[model samples]
Target: MHFAIVGAGFTGAVLANELAKAGHNVTVYEIRPHVAGNCYSERDEKTGILLHKYGPHIFHTDNEEVWNYVNQFTDFMPYVNRVKTTSQGNVYSLPINLLTINQYFGKTLSPKEANDFIKSLADGEIDEPQTFEEQAMKFVGKDLYEAFFKGYTLKQWGRSPKELPASILKRLPVRFNYDDNYFNHKYQGMPKNGYTPIVERLLDHANITLHLNTPFSSENKVSVDHVFYTGPIDAWFNYNAGRLGYRTLDFVREDHEGDYQGCAVMNYADEKVPYTRISEHKHFSPWEEQERTVIFKEYSRKCEEGDIPYYPIRLVNEKTMLNAYIGKAKKEKNVSFMGRLGTYRYLDMDVTIAEALDASRKTLDCVNKNKPIPVFFVNPL
Candidate 1:
């Protein structure tokens, strides 16, 4: 069977590779000139430092299958993401570890002592928290919430914490121990070269054809047995239902003589600060050495037309519109919606690849059994 893949990101690339390996003709369309989508990385002309064009993406996953799958393409260097945040005019470790707690409160407390102290600070009145503010207050109390989360959340989402859901805060961890590793995944590292090469290898199958700078739309006519779309769901239907809300990012790049922030990522948790975080690209790949460095200051705002969508704002309004699009997608024939944008969810790199692999397996099974392909392999909601 012939397969048409929209967008050359990880999802489309993985699907194309799998189908091609099955002796099916696969064609991939990428609107961007480059592959890998947001994970695209390249070396700076002057500094010779590898820069993540969109933002820093650390490959961290507890899934052993995902770790082994990506390893087949490129060598991964040993790298753990240790993030820092500047809040209240002081630098502190992120994830609100024991060190941050002690430094902020001016007390050297043991793990047990710190846990009890934080519990005392937490508001006991809120039995069941609904909003982000309530969740933070119930978890770490008002002091830490205001100093660490409030200002930064407002800047990143462009909305007050009270307006957001508690589920957003649930993803962030507050550890009593001094472990500052950003993620708790078993496997964590960056590609030895860059993500682009890994994706290039994924699409290098003999039966796969890649078309860069080619946009896919419902209007375009294609002679494929099936279509796998990884673009925004609303875009597939031309936003007939309504546009789903998303927060887009703006990156401001700057060059420096030596190390910039002395870290891969340093987030600014102060509302007064214009940018949320500063990422020093050279620091990302510690295996390589460079005299010069490059940094990108990140700012977030409401996504507009033609802007690349980063985080999906799955508020009440967006959920309603997303359901409508999902309905339309299900009614379509010979089409499957996959990936973060298609499903309208914030997906990690590992989850994205895992889902793609599962979708490919399901597709192959359906084809072999002479059954109809599923519109969605996994539930979006």
Candidate 2:
């Protein structure tokens, strides 16, 4: 069977590779000229630093299969994403660990003392959380939530904590002990040559034909057995139902000598900062040598026309809009929705790749048996 895969990101690339390996012809249509989507990286001409074209993407995953699969394309360097936050003109370790708590309070707090202190701070009345703020307060109390999450959440989502769902807050951790590693994943690293080369190698197969700077038309389907759409669900149907909600990013680049923030990621957890975080590019690849460092001050806003979509903002209104699209999606015959935009959920690189692999396996099994493909590969709603 021949398949037409939309977008050359990990979703499409992985699907294309799988189908091609199964003796099926696969054609990938990428609107962007490059592969890897947001994780695309290449050597910068100005300073010879490998720039994360969209932003910084540090590959971290617990799944051994995913770790091994990614390693097939390029060698990976061991790296831990040690993140810090700048709030009220001071720097503190992220995840609200014991070290952060001690530093913020300016007291040498023991594990037992810190635990009891936090318990004292928490509001016991709100047993179940309905919103992001409530969930955060329940776990870490008000002071920490206000200092770290509240302002950043407001800036990132463009909504108050009461307006946002509790699930968003659950993604972030609140540690009782002092462990500053941002991700709790067992395996965390980066590609030796960068993400683009790895993605390029994934799509490199005899049966795979890539068409860059090309967009697929829903009205005119390519001559293939099935289509796997990694693009926005609303865009595929020409926004007939309604436009799906998305939060886009704007990167303000600044050049600095020697070092910028000492850490790779520094979150500005105050509304006064304007930008949510500043990602120092030099810190991303510690293996390289460069005197000057480039930092991208990230600003999140409501996705606009001709803007690169970064995060998905699935507020209540957006959920209603997404449900309508999913309804239409179920009735579709050939195409299947996969990945973050397709499912209308924010997925990290690990989750994204895991879903893609699962989707590919199920899709291939159905195709081989001449069975109907499922509407949603991984359910978001």
Candidate 3:
């Protein structure tokens, strides 16, 4: 069977590779001139540093199978995502660890006592959290939430925490211990060369062809036996129910001599600061050394027409629009929508690959047994 993958992100590239390996021809269509989508990385000529074209993406997951799968393409270096934050002109550690708690309160309390004190700070009257603000207040109290999450969340989503759903805030960790690791996944590392090479590896097969700067639509969907669309689901149906809500990021690049920010990521917790976070590219790959460094002050805002959508603002209205798109997708024929934009859910790199692998495996099985393909691989939609 021949497959046309709509976007060359991890979901499309991995599935393309998997299906191609199983005796199928695949062509990946990407509007962007490059592959790997948001995770694309390239070398900076002046500083010779690998720049994360979109933002920093730390590969962290507990799944050994995922770790080995990526390792087959490129060697990963030990990279710990130790994030720092500045709130109200005060600098502190992230994930609300012991150091942050002690520094914020101007006291050196033990981990256990710190945990208890935080529990004390929480509003006891609030039994159930219905919004992001409520969830933050319940978990870490008002002070921490205000200092760390409130302004950032507002800037990231372009909405007050009260207007957002509780599930959005649940992704953040409120640790009572000294563990300051941004992600709790057992396997954490970064691609030694960059994510671009890993993606290049996935598309290096002879049977696979890549068509960059291609805007795919339903008109071109007839050649392939099945379709794996990683583009926006609403766009697939020509926005019949209007566009979904998404937040796009604008990166303000600044070049500096020596180390900048002293860490990989620095969250600007104050509302006055326009950008939510500033990422120092050099710190991501510690093994490399360069006198000059570069940083991207990330400004999040509502995605305008023709803007690169970074994160989806899945508010009530957005969800309603998404459901309408999903309904249209259900009625469609010979196309399987997968990945974040396809399913209208926020997915990390690991989960996207896992789902794509499963999808490819099932697709292969169906062809062998002469069965029809599915509309979706994962059922989060």
- Rank order by lDDT, top first? 1, 3, 2
Score every model by TM-score: 0.99, 0.97, 0.98
- lDDT by residue for model 1 (166-272), tens: 98887558899999999999999999999999999999999999999999865543588899999999998999998999999999988888887899999999999
Model 2 C-alpha lDDT per residue in residues 1-381, reported as the tens digit of each score: 878888898888888888889889998989988888988898878888888978889999989999888888899999999999998788999878889999887878888998888888888888889899889888778888889989998899998998888988775576778898888999999888789987898899999999999988764365777888888988878888777778899999898889988988999999878899999988888998899888899999999878878788887788898889998898888888888778878888888888888888998899779898887887778
Q: Model 2 misses residue 116 by how many Å?
A: 0.7
If ranked by TM-score, best first, what sequence of candidates would result?
1, 3, 2
- Expressed as tens digits, the lDDT of each residue in 30-110 for candidate 3 is 999999999999999989999999999999998888899999999999988999999988889888899999989998999
Clashes of each: 0, 0, 0
lDDT leader: 1
- Note the residue pairs that clash in candidate 3: none
lDDT of 1 at 144: 97
Alpha-carbon runs more than 4 Å astray in model 3: none
Worst 10 residues of 3 by lDDT: 169-178
Local distance difference test, per candidate?
0.93, 0.86, 0.89
Candidate scoring better on TM-score of 2 and 3: 3
Cα error, residue 109 of model 2, in Å, equals 1.2
